[model samples]
Target: MKGYYQGFLIRDWQECDRNNAANILHSVLTEYGLPWLPTGADKDVIKVEEFYLATGGEFWVVEKQGKVVGTAAYYPVKRGEKAVEIRKMYLLPEARGQGLGKYLLTELEKTIENKGFREIWIETASVLKEAVKLYESSGYQAASGVETPRCDRIYVKYLPLE
Candidate 1:
């Protein structure tokens, strides 16, 4: 899954993309007042293959002019019937306000649904107002049980299986 979207190359995680992906995630997390815990919630950022692809999930990196600028990923979970949790969705400041976040989210939902995932979960902090807004506006309803130490809100959306 790779292509140019609005001049940005969106592609699956590659071995060479490890460092850049981690950096972008860390930068955005810190910018939003969240700690960069490589040994905790963010551990997957450094081991994309083992944490995502190897587990029937996916991680993507967005690049612009040869510079990595964003990431989006999701993995299977047991909280619901055929469910997956969206994680590691981040974008550099400069790459924001251009609909890339919305685009990535729409793309993720479509892919997840196509892959037979019936429900999607998301955990986020209130400080990330944009994310909260995006989730709500996209039909994700407020939920509970935020397992991440830094996240305070949870949202879940169920896809209609065709």
Candidate 2:
């Protein structure tokens, strides 16, 4: 599938046998963040790997040209309840402005709704204006007065499974 931008592909993190997961994380921390860091952040990478391995959460990679250009994760917030948290959503710098983020989000919402989740919640830093816009346009509403130490905005959208 090299050089092809077919609809975003979703697969298990472990299924990414080419170490794209690590590349995805490094890209997010370096290319997308404030400052690029040296490739010696082994501890951070291990921590994320451990979480991915231990949780019931699922990680998905978005590929274009056979390269993992984006990633996202979803995990249950409460057992036996239709609630989940969307986290660690990242896309490579070269992959932005192509509506791939929105595509991933739409896929996630549909998947959650199909799985009986009544609502989907996400938290994003206030500085990420594009993300805020994506969420808002996708029917997510700003959560009033809700605050988290790591993020300035929290949004929620209800999925009606009729």
Candidate 3:
């Protein structure tokens, strides 16, 4: 994945991006008063590619002159699952409003669709109303079954795989 907006570069996650990914995840969690070292977050940030590649998934980061400013990833519910879940996507305050979120999401969606996934899901806290709207505007619909204490809402999107 390669994308740039106003000098911010979007690319695949590498081992060296570990600290940056963890920092971005930590910053978002702290900003929202959420736990910064939850089990899921810990595992993903430290070993992003390891977590995703095993399930044919991918993690990406947006960097400003080599410093990570945004993060996103999608992984299968199971190794051979038909659908995948989007996780830990965030952009720093300085990175928002530049359409980077939408741009990153578009690339992520294309990645899953290209990988032959028929559906994708994402969940978020009710407090993040902007995130909810972003998901809704991007062809995702309200979905149920996700009951994480960290999030109160789930949204899903279907793709036409060719």
Q: Would you list the C-alpha lDDT of every candidate in the order shown?
A: 0.93, 0.66, 0.82
Candidate 2 Cα misplacement greater than 4 A, ranges: 1-8, 15-19, 29-55, 79-81, 144-148
Which clashing pairs does model 2 show? 3-65
Note the clash tally of each candidate: 0, 1, 0
RMSDs, each prediction? Answer: 0.8, 4.7, 2.0
What candidate 1 gets wrong by more than 4 Å, as runs, is none
Q: Write the per-residue lDDT of candidate 3 for residues 1-162, one digit (tens) a residue.
A: 577778988888888888888888889878988777647645767877678877688888888976789888999875224898898789989898888888878888988888889889898887777788789999999878774567889988988857
Error of 1 at 74 (Å): 0.6
Error of 2 at 148 (Å): 5.4
Give the Cα-based TM-score of candidate 2 against the true structure.
0.73
Show the colliding residue pairs in model 1. none
- Residue 93 CA displacement from its true place in model 3, Å: 0.5
Per-residue C-alpha lDDT of model 2 across residues 89-132, encoded as one tens digit per residue: 77877888987788778777777777777878887776677888
Best by lDDT: 1
Give the range where candidate 1 is weakest over 10 consecutive residues by summed lDDT: 1-10
The local lDDT score (0 to 100) that residue 121 gets in candidate 2 is: 83
